[model samples]
Target chain A: MNRYSLNQATTKYWPLEDVVAASAKAELDWIGLWREPVQEYGVERAAKLVADAGLRVSSLCRGGFFTATDDAERRAKIEDNRRAIDEAATLGTDVLVLVSGGLPAGSRDVDGARAMVTDGLAELAPYAGERGVRLAVEPLHPMFCSDRCVVSSLGGALDLAEQFPADQVGVIVDAYHLWWDADVYRQIARAGDRICSYQVSDWIVPLPADNLLGRGMMGDGAIELRRLREACDAAGYDGPVEVEIFNQQLWDAPGQEVFDLAYQRYTEHVA
Target chain B: MNRYSLNQATTKYWPLEDVVAASAKAELDWIGLWREPVQEYGVERAAKLVADAGLRVSSLCRGGFFTATDDAERRAKIEDNRRAIDEAATLGTDVLVLVSGGLPAGSRDVDGARAMVTDGLAELAPYAGERGVRLAVEPLHPMFCSDRCVVSSLGGALDLAEQFPADQVGVIVDAYHLWWDADVYRQIARAGDRICSYQVSDWIVPLPADNLLGRGMMGDGAIELRRLREACDAAGYDGPVEVEIFNQQLWDAPGQEVFDLAYQRYTEHVA
Candidate 1:
């Protein structure tokens, strides 16, 4: 059965191991793991915990951030993504999410930044393909247009994914970021089976204080989740809806409380 | 020739007619008047005042909040637009700025809302066309997707223009709203001669307290103004560079000061 996967970032106040244990405690079917936590607890421990907790590793949190000042640093990011692909494979995660990094520092060339992403993805794709892991390029909000993901539209992601004909290249469409796009449904239809994951959240505040981070939880914001789901469904998209909120206040909440909130809101806001 | 056209909402504190006088005092070449102000002054008085002040109406503030719950109110808005068209004609302003309203109240049907806009545009285009008034559909920021403009991309605007091909159909590629689009340049190029006016302002914050209001003056935000001009130039778009900033703080200052600040920022930022 396709089940709810809480991107542990919702309960990021807790340590990675604890969050995994708590997701297990909450009986969540799957968990989306973040990088820092995996690195802190070590990949072996994270993998062991996922096995013990009976949680499917839905996706390894992130891999890309290819934009950089120099070629060597850019190459280093590619190497890191290769490692991330391996890590996702070890964790039995089918998708390795790629966050195409924002503009290289002091550079206003978005086209150049995108070129770097495509080139980096070219390097990471073969490795990820060999490891049996899908690469899901996530399109963030244009508010992150400067320092975060350069992939701001689903069309841009689709353009990038077109470079790879196989299923290894996919997109992670989040409601929080893409709920406003005029062509989101068309893009989702374009994505089809390549939509590795469907992320849900609401747009609570009109203005986000922190551009890259401040995401609202379900029901608390303006996005009508069921409508978005209807759009995805209308587009013939069937994939796991990952609850990925980056609310600072939600992160500070107790782990169980966060899980309870996510669950409660899931039914009220997301369904 | 470059002309300074003060979009009135940037200084909401001034009443309709007073803004007209102040605009003339500032030696601005043009003024973009909103509907409320004209209604407040009455169409005859509003028309006479601009004529008396020797001011040019660059564009009428707008028409088309087409997404409505009932047909009666929607028809009423169209009726109101007709009056605005008459007023624009009376004031010798041929540019009728049309912002396709946001998703209807208590609705998440963006596509339905957009269809309503295209229909509205189709209905109004012939009338405005006969009157020699070109309706410039302004594609607002993605943030306005909920309660403001549904047309969030330049491509979306171009598509509308294509759908209703007329000398009357054009676009207002406001930099603050469109600076972040991945295909902004391409879409602008596509707009070509259909590009009626180019507006400039900076996005000071991602989401201000008043999302509809609170625009940053050019140079205050991250957008590279010169680069935008270069892109527009490359696309063969040579039209009036309308300085349209909706900053509450700037509006609060004296009217002449507002123009002074706008002019100063334009020269400094666009330099």
Candidate 2:
């Protein structure tokens, strides 16, 4: 329970105020946030709201999508990422998760798209570093490689992150996205201090119509949540274990109920 | 076109007779057969049908699902695999593709399941070799790791295959599955003569309800099909490049129409 953090996405429909209050009420030490809701609630207000409730912001949801075919679109994506970095800084979170965008539309050049991600990170890492924000490169499940993130493995993320300082760029080890790899344990160990965030979610089968929302709650699917968490801990990631499920059923549940269940599962399956 | 082979699964609903006749009419040199249809039509008859049509069986569709919780069930799966080897032998194809089963139900031990795959291969490899069949271990896309296959990357498959004689065991380099990995090209190079089959299928986004049927025609999705085929060739694999798509739309189309479109796409994207 001491290391448990309820990522806002677990209860996506829950208001910022309600989530902050619930985290504090639940006596949690940290709360992970998303950029959209924090901006909507006013970054300063959201920051103060969590600070007032004595909950530290664990991380800001995202800041990448660098793959684009044209220069104009690529520049625009970089600009959007700069704003996300600023938002992460303002929210008082050191970590800003980046879901590196997929290949550009109508493009079969995966190498070119990955190169774009490398360029995006090179452009943003220094800017993020100055603001005390670590850009966490999240390797989404390979299923999302075509339309979501091009970084599809922790090793791939580390390859990109190795180019930058550990404090400026790191990797997010999300159980649901990585549990399938036979090399995961080895990669997790290699992650070491570059592990900026350790997120726990189970891999449920028969992924729903919207595969993005197919993440199951911890202990609900095939992932070895505790084993992964222990691997992170052994790798020296003494940080918040964020429960960040994106299932529609979880979203429809009462905010407090979802939060409670997440905390319970974290204790049982991840702690 | 000389290297092109159309796997029967691409037109799953098409009768075997029509498929064989269509392949012969298309002037294709090779065809890949699935176990179920070949068994349904009687293995000897299907073998004769293709042989008489001047077409060769490039490979057999499958012979795995080795992970099972119970000892009795495990033995049954091994027996089934032996029968699959015999079927492949009868069909005059050296390669028998294997989709290693996922974690057993009520199990979180992925490592244990992978071990089961290794054990299954060790037991069957000698038997397969005696019958002139090379067990081609296919590392399915990681999305299917929990349900369809635990061997989720080319490197993982290579690790399993390297344990046995190259003549007895090999790996399947399916572009649709291995295309997303950054380490894929290096792994392909490492495969060398252990490459048994090179399969091509485009990976489309917004995967359908049945994720298994989400594979797209070659030119319709993001995979760098030509690059992957070239990689296989560079790795000393002068084998047939099988177009194995599992899409609902392809299955619903007229068999010849689908075959024509696949040949055209394979010419443009994979050849």
Candidate 3:
């Protein structure tokens, strides 16, 4: 319970105020946030709201989609990431998760897209480091490789992150995305202090109509959540264990109920 | 088109007789068969039908699912695999593709399930070799790791296959499954002569309700089909390149129409 944090995505429809209040009421030490809701609630107000409740911001949801074919589009993405870094800084969170965008439209050049991600990170790492924000490269499940994130493995993410200082760039080890890898334990050990965030979500089968919302709550599917959390701890990641699920059924539930269940599952399956 | 083969799964709804006639009429070098249809059409009759038409059976669709918890269930799966090997032998196809089953019911021990796969292969490889069948372990896309196959990468599959003689065991380089892997090129190079079957299919986004049927025709999605085929060729595989797509839209189309479109796409994107 000391390390448990409820990522806002677990209760996506929950209002920012309600989530912050609920986390504090539940006596949680932290809450992970997304960029959109914080901006909507006013970044300063959201920051003060959490600060007033004595809850630290564990991480900011995202700040990358840098793959683009044209120069202007690429520059625009870099600018957007810059704003994301600023938002993370303002929110007082050191971790800004990055889901590097997939291949450009009508393009089969995966190598070219990967290069763009490396370039995006090389440009943004210094800016993020200056603001005390660590850009956490999240390797999405390979299922999302074409349209969501080109970085599809922790090893691949580390390959990109090792190019920069560990404080400037790190990797997010989300169970849902990486539990299927045979080399996951080895990579997790290799990650050591490079693991910026450790997120837990079970891998459920018969992924819904839209696969993006297919993540199951911890202990609800086929992931070894405790094992992975232990692996992170073994690798020296003494950080918040964020429960981040994106299931439609969980979203349809009451926000408080979802939060309570997430906390409970984190206790039993992750923490 | 000398090396082109139309896998029957691309037009699953087509009758076996029609598919055989169409492949012969299209002047294709070979036809890939599924176990169920070949069994239903009578293996001997189907074998004679293809042989009489001057076409060869490039490979058998499948022969694995060995991750059962109960001893009886495990034995049943091994028996089924034995039958599948016999079917492949009768069909005159040297390659028998194996999709290792996922985690056992209510189990999260992926490592344990993988061991079951290795055990299954070790037990069956000699039997398959005696029947002149090479057990080709296919590493399905990781999305299917929890349900359809536990072997989720060429490297993982190789880790299992390398324990057996190259003549008894090999790997399938399916473009749709292995394209997203960052280490795929290196794995393909390591596969070298261990490559038994080369499969091609494009990976389209917004996967359908049943994600299993979401594979698109070659030119309709994100896979670099030509590059993968070249990789297989460079690995010393000059065998038939099978176009194996599992799409609902393509299945609903006329068999000959789907076949013609697949041939064109394979010519432009894979061959």
Winning model by DockQ: 2
Report the C-alpha displacement of residue A15, candidate 3, in angstroms. Answer: 1.6
The local lDDT score (0 to 100) that residue B98 gets in candidate 1 is 85
Pairs in clash, predicted candidate 3: none
Two-way TM-score contest, 1 vs 2, winner? 2
Question: How much lDDT does each candidate structure score?
Answer: 0.79, 0.93, 0.93
Candidate 2 ranges with C-alpha deviation above 4 Å: none
Rank by DockQ (best first): 2, 3, 1
**Which regions of candidate 3 are displaced past 4 Å?**
none
Report the lDDT tens digits of candidate 2 across residue range B1-271: 4888999999999999998999898888999999999999999999999999999999998989999999999999999999999999999999999999999998999999999999999999999999999999999999999898999999999999999999999999999899999999999999999999899888987899999999998888998888888989999999899989999888999989999999998888888
Please report, as a residue range, the 10-residue window in candidate 2 chain B with the lowest summed lDDT.
B1-10
Give me the overall lDDT of model 3. 0.93
Can you list the residue pairs that collide in candidate 1? A204-A221, A207-B207, B215-B246
Ranking 1 against 3 by DockQ, winner: 3
Worst 10 residues of 1 chain B by lDDT: B205-214
